[model samples]
Target: TAHRWIGRAYFFAGVFPAGIAVLGVAPLSSTGFVSQVGNTMLAVLWLATSIAGYRMARQRRFVEHRRWMIRSFALTTSIVLNRAWLILFVILLLPHVDTTYGGDQDAMIRAAAGASAWMSWVVNLLVAEWWLERGDARRRTHRTGQAADRRDAA
Candidate 1:
């Protein structure tokens, strides 16, 4: 349960930045007053969620501190991975895609920048989720084995 909450918090933290960035990139005036308000709410919610998660972890209610720590680390790592992915995508994938799409040099640069940014965000989110899930699974398995050993010893 605590682990799940931590995961949710981390998920929201990642989403908040991405959402803010998206809104920053978008033509906000194209939307209405409500949209702007909603964006602000999202930013607030993101911060709240992150704080709640940290508080929960500090409480140390769950014996699965290892699991939570691994998850927190994995979540924090997305930032680094996101930047790396963006750089690689721009340098490698974007050029190929632009050329295949028959864009001129200037057009290709613009397209690559736009596409790489979006793709990098998506890829980073997916990879972060996968890493967290895998880490959780591994932790669970190790815990189960330890429990079994204790039982056998008794």
Candidate 2:
């Protein structure tokens, strides 16, 4: 399964390094403490979800595996989504940051980064759950249609 393979690749390449950097190097840096902590937790969550998905796949619990994969994928894409949020923040709020952060540019940037960091993954996860529910509903509809057709044939 490509999904399983992709999960493996993403775990090794993306999540692992993020965990290492966040848990280790970020602490040494003198910037963005709140965002660093949030992202560190996010990295840990991503790793946990990725491993859970792999375990479900190994156990042949494919439906559960798919659900976890969707979560993992959402977390993975949050990096990109984070940028999108940051862009929105910049466009919509950067100019008004003087009133918000009292003209402290660094503070404003950090606040934006932290908010985007948290929002990206949280929003994506919500959307993923919505997607999963939609998939479940569609599958249920399809099964119902199939059952009706079989009864008619009999």
Tell me the whole-model lDDT of each prediction, alpha carbons only: 0.53, 0.81
Residues 111-148, model 1: lDDT tens digits: 44454444433454457568768877999999999999
Across 39-106, the per-residue lDDT of candidate 2 in tens digits comes to 77678778788889878988999989989988988988988988999878777768877898888987
Candidate 1 residue pairs in clash (backbone atoms < 3 Å): none
lDDT of 1: 0.53
**What TM-score, to 2 decimals, does candidate 1 have?**
0.45
Candidate 1 positional error at 28, Å: 7.2
Q: Residue 131 of model 1: what lDDT?
A: 75
Once superposed on the true structure, which residue ranges of model 1 sit more than 4 Å away at CA? 1-24, 28-90, 93-103
**Model 1 residue-pair collision total:** 0
TM-score, per-candidate, Cα-based? 0.45, 0.80
